[model samples]
Target: MSKELRSNFHEQLTEIRDGIAQMGAGVTELVPRATQILLDGDLEAAEYVILGDNEYDAKAVELEERCFSVIALQAPVASDLRSLVSAIKIIADIERSADLCVNICKAARRIYGHDLDPSLRGVIQKMGNQARVLFKESTEAYLNLDGPRAAALHDMDSYLDDLQRQFIQVIFESHAAGTIDLQVAVQLAVVARFYERIGDHAVNVGDRVRYIVDGWVPEHPYAESDNDPPEIVDGVIVPAGQS
Candidate 1:
């Protein structure tokens, strides 16, 4: 590549990277607070999150377009190509996670007048906090290309999954005890599920980051996200002179 071409590529790449960082930071502020919007019935805060979702969606679309432009104009290969691929995938995940935050906000509106069962409220709050942590760590892994840490996000996701399960049990218990009416229980359940889905999206970001660094995804989502060196499997990693 010419010096001019290389320079332009690097500059565009930096811009996209910075944009991804900014977007991640924006979403982080909302995930944990979304539950508060629900519990507190803060219509104002819920509206704020909904507006932020629009911004995230717009940014994601713009970043994805930039990625495609780079691919078409620069024909990036190797790590250069991987960078674009990672950005594309990460943006999608981030955008979806933000949408889930909006879902939580909408759920908050539906339950505005109905006080959540105390038991269910605790679990939802915990889930929201855990979701925030996952998104933050996932963004760090993506920006730093920390494959081992990114791979480990799955372990973190398991905790959120457990919280969701606990939410279910609590909801059932609350209803059985006549502490929470069926309508409120249903709304809180949707809110909990939204938080759980946000965690899943963060894990997806981690998966993409690991793939960007390592150049492959395990056939299964559950595969370890370690920095272990690759090994031969059948003909997959043939030796230097042995095809």
Candidate 2:
């Protein structure tokens, strides 16, 4: 490649990376806003998060187009090939993250104007915090090209899964004890599920980072443990609660 052509390619790649980062940041904001809306019973905030989905979708489409253009025009090889491929995969993950945020907003709408038990709120908040941390760390790993950091982010997804299980157990126990109304318990379940899905998307981003650096895709969607089943302490599973 000529020096000038190489410079232009680098510029385009930088733009693509920046676009992905913008999408990541946008979805990160959405997660917290959606969680807060649910916690505060704020219908307007929840609606805003829902409406913001279009922006994320648009950016993702643009990023994908840019990646395609780079791959076709530059004919990148080796690490460059991996980077472009990773960009394509990252855009898909970002789109799904946005969709998960939309789901959270939808859950918030269902529970709008309803009072939630403080314990349930606490559980949701904890899940939200964990999801946010995973998102931030995954993006940082991408920006820094730190595959090990990305791998660590995948490990954190298990924490989100554990928290989701605890949330569901609390809801079930509360309903069984007659402390929480069945209807409210079900809504809280949906909220926890949304948060759990957000965590899954974050792990997906981490996997993409691994692909970017090592050109290797994870066999499973979520973090996998070294131990085998039957003796496995926590199995690797996407969306959690399923084999």
Candidate 3:
């Protein structure tokens, strides 16, 4: 490749990376707001989160198009190609995560008037905190290319799953006691699922981050690739759960 062409491709690549990073940051900010809105029954805040999703969606679409354009125009191979591929996958995960937040906001709308059982509310709030930490750490891992740190997220995710189930059990307890209406219980269940889904998406991004930094896509069928991308640093550097 000519010098000018290589420079231009690098610039485009940086822009794409920055775009994904910004998207990650956007979601990181929104997660806490979504959780707070849920806890406080803030209908106005819920509406804000719901409407903000469109901006993130537009960003996702633009990033995906940029990735495809880079592939077509630069024919980036090896690490350059791998970087773009990982960006595409990461963007998808981030977008879904943003949707999950929007889903939480939607759930907020459904249950705003219902009084939550105190025990169930506490557990659900903890789950929200866990998920927000995961989201923040996952984003940091992506921006820093910390492979091992990315892998560490799965443990916390397992814990998040357990917390989600506990929240549901509490809801069941409330329902059995005739404290919460059936419709309200179901709505809270859906809210728990949304937060749990956010954790899943964070773990998905962690896997992608490891792939980007170490070029070692895990033994998952969906991640199997034909290209012989260059290997960097022998082992994965998974990011652990952050405070």
Candidate 4:
């Protein structure tokens, strides 16, 4: 590749990376905003979040397309190819996390006028804050190329899982105490699930970051093995395979 061509390729990759980061930042804000809408019963905020998802979805699609274009046109190899593949996966995770926030807002609207007990409210707040933190940390890991921090996101996500369990228990107790009816309890349970899923998606982003940095994917014990098929490098297939 010519020096000018290589420079252009890197610039495109950087733009895609920045786009993904912007999406992550948007999701981080959406989580807290949706949670507040749930806690405060703000229908206007709920509607805003619900409608805003359309724009997020559109941007995600555009970003994914850009990643694919770079792969097709530039024909990146080695770490560069890995980064593009991981980026596509990361973009999906971030997009889904954003959709989960919209789900939270929809749940809030469903349970409008319902009041949550203090115990339930407290757990919800903690879960929302934790979800936001998880995404923020994962984005930072991607930005800084911090593999260890990206790996730590899995452990960090365990707390969010615990919070989801605690919130469920509080929901049952609140129902038993007549603090909330069955309908509200069910909606709140779904809301808790939305928050938990957001954390899971954030962890997924971390996994993709690890892949981008070092070809480490959780499902694969080893990135490559002797039994594996011929490798593709620099747009050519090695060891007798087609280009």
Candidate 5:
């Protein structure tokens, strides 16, 4: 590639990176906003979060197109190609995290008049804050190419998972004690899962960041190449017609 062409390519890559960071920042902001809407029964804030998801969806589609264009036009090899591919995956994670926030808001709207006990409220707050922190750190790791910090997000997600468990237990306790009705408890339980799923998405973003930095593939059964035939063992079922 000519020097001028290389320079333009790098510039395009920078713009894509900046766009991802901007999206990540926006999604992180919604976490706390949704949590507050739930805790305070703020109908206005719930509407804002729900409406904001459309913009994020549009942004994600645009970012994905840009990444695809860069790959087609520049044919980036090795790390450049990996980075662009990872950016595409990271965009999906960020967008889904935003959708989870929207779900939380929708849950808030569903239980609009129900008041949460202090214990349930506290746990929800902690999960929201933790999810925000995870996304922020993952975005920074991507921007900085800090693989170690990106890898650490998985461990950090455990706290959010624990919070979800605790929150569910509280919901059950509150329902038993007649503090909250069963319908409200059910909505709150789903809301807890949404927060936990956001943390999962954040960890996914971090995994993509690690891939960009070092070509690391997370270990999973489906990570193998499609052309590779499945191995058959005693009583083990391989893919159909591939044994």
Candidate 6:
């Protein structure tokens, strides 16, 4: 490549990286804001989170366009091809993660105007906090291209799965004992499921980071059990088995 063309390519690559980082920051903020809305039972805050989803969508679209431009104009190959591919994939994951936050906020609004048992609220809030931390760490790993840090996020997600399982058991126990209203138990179950999914998406970002840097997809770090684990026969885990 000519020096001028190389320089342009590097600049475009930098812009893509910066754009991803900006989107990551925006998505990261949504997690806490959505959780706060849930904790405070604030309808307005929930609405704000729902509206903000569009912002993330727009950013993802912009990043996708940029990646397409780089591929078409620069004709990247090998590692550059991997980086562009990873950027495209990561944007989708990031956008979905943002959407999950919006969904959580919507759920919070649905549960608003009703008095939730404090114990259930406590559990949901704790799960939200844990998810937010994972989101932040996973994005940081992506921005830094730190495979080791990205690898570590899988363990954090495992903690989230354990929390979700414990919360599910609590809900079932409460329902069986007639301690929690069935409707409330169901709502809490949905909330727990959302939190678990958020953790999964964060792990996806980590996997994409590995793909970009190492040109290989990593196994899902959050698989529940060794027995009957999600099939990762090759580098890529089968989507069907991904929780």
Distance from true location, Cα of 160 in model 1, Å: 0.3
- The TM-score between candidate 3 and the true structure equals 0.88
lDDT of 5 by residue, 14-37 (tens): 999999999999988888988888
Weakest ten-residue segment in model 1 by summed lDDT: 224-233
lDDT of 4 by residue, 56-156 (tens): 88999999999999999999999999999988888888887887787777677767887887899899999999999999999999987789999999899
**CA lDDT of each candidate?**
0.79, 0.76, 0.81, 0.84, 0.84, 0.77
| Per-residue alpha-carbon lDDT of candidate 6 for residues 59-100, written as tens digits (9 for 90 to 100) | 899999999988998899988898898888778877877877
Among all windows of ten consecutive residues in candidate 6, which has the lowest summed lDDT?
225-234
Sort by lDDT, top down from the best: 5, 4, 3, 1, 6, 2
Which model scores highest in TM-score?
Answer: 5
Best by lDDT: 5
Higher-ranked by lDDT: 2 or 3 = 3
Superposition TM-score, candidate 4 onto the true structure: 0.89
| Residue pairs of candidate 1 with colliding backbone atoms | 151-225
- Candidate 1 ranges beyond 4 A from true positions: 221-243
Regions of model 2 farther than 4 Å from truth: 221-243
Tens-place lDDT per residue, model 3, 1-243, is: 999999999999888888898898888878888888888889998888887878988999999999999999889898888899989988988887888787777667767788877897798779888998888889989888898889999998999999999999999999999988877777777778777878888888888888878788667654412211111111322221110
Q: Model 2 misses residue 239 by how many Å?
A: 15
Worst 10 residues of 4 by lDDT: 222-231
TM-score of each: 0.87, 0.87, 0.88, 0.89, 0.90, 0.86
lDDT of 4: 0.84
The count of residue-pair clashes in candidate 4 stands at: 0
Pitting candidate 3 against candidate 6, the one with the higher TM-score is 3
CA shift at 190, candidate 3, in angstroms? 1.2
